[model samples]
Target: MDLLIDSFVSAILLVVSLDAEMIAIVGVSIKVSLTSTLFASIIGIPLGFAIAFGDAPGKRWMITILNTLLALPTVVIGLFVYTFISRRGVFGPFDLLYTQRAIIIGQLILIIPVVTAFTISAISRIDERYRKTAMTLGADRIQTAWVVFREARFGIGAAVIAAFGRVISEVGISMMLGGNIRGFTRTMTTAMALEYDKGSFTLAIALGLVLLSFSFGMNMLFHFFQGRSRL
Candidate 1:
């Protein structure tokens, strides 16, 4: 109990003082997570709209695959990406293994399905009349998509936020793909794992507090968007 208290107090000090190392880890995490989320949203948003509206063959199977992928383990994604990026692999010549970019790639794979599946669910919930009404008004395919897009904006925002939250909290991909190299690919989750293994409680606790704070903020935003979606 005393040890925990001491570590907690020291963690608060580290956070309040803006410890350089902590900030660096946090920065790397934020950068990787945001980059992955941005790209995933760009791709997933359009892809989800297509799946939701299109009647192409095998569309149902594609959605099933994406829904299954939402639960894919991060380690599996890490190892799968590693196979291609590691030396002696097909893309080995590119030297992507153990880099921040590598981490981003793994995270992007991990969350793209999340964003897409959530987006599909969101679009599915909209009234069928919205699409009919848009078409009745002579809205072209693109314009009709925009109408549904605007109506589903809140749910889609929640999807984006959920993607961000997923990647930021994940450790396996960051550790396996990034190699947790300090001053470069190290991230909050990786740093905390390293600190805990070293029995250095202060820094671990500090990062945990920071992580939890962000999680709280994310949950609040998620609920806000969810409420807005219902309206």
Candidate 2:
């Protein structure tokens, strides 16, 4: 259709021009996603390793809960976090609502389960003999854990990549918690949503193209690491 073609061309021009608003939205998206992913990895990776290697009772239940949370809706996470941070809510005194920190918190919650589940799966797939072998070689508990983590590094990396993908493209948490304030909290996803709602498809299409390209690159890296893991 002519409209589609025009929109596509306009989007390309917008991207090529590095429009200020577009750049700002993209920057915010990357900042929030990377921050949340880092926090999620910091907490989730260790939690996964602990659950996988430790003899904690009811670990099955813990893992089951985490796995179940992988399917949790983004809006649900946004709503849950908003409840605590919003005015008149439990932690309302902190005034976290509608801020980058609030968006990060929601996104952190969203990706924690993803990273933890993937990490657990990754570590669980490693041969049990590795642990026994490490112990036989006089590796202490800490050293053995380190060895296990090294063996599963690729999978853990994949988990991180996946978490990045999820948080970067998600709109609900960013919109709900960040309030989509232009030049402040607005991100690519939220901007795209706003543009689409306003029937301004050019910018939305541009953001989509950028987001898709980014996700594709991440997937390629994920597959590369996954393939390398087998070697």
For each candidate in turn, give its C-alpha RMSD to the true structure in angstroms: 0.8, 0.9
TM-score of 2: 0.98
- Worst-scoring 10-residue span by lDDT in model 2: 222-231
Model 1 TM-score relative to the real fold? 0.98
Clashing pairs in 1: none
Q: What is the alpha-carbon lDDT of model 1 when measured against the actual structure? A: 0.94
List the candidates' TM-scores in order: 0.98, 0.98
lDDT of 2 by residue, 143-175 (tens): 999999999999999999999999999999999
After TM-score superposition, the amount by which residue 58's alpha carbon in candidate 1 deviates from its true location, in angstroms, is: 1.7
- Candidate 1 lowest-lDDT run of ten: 47-56
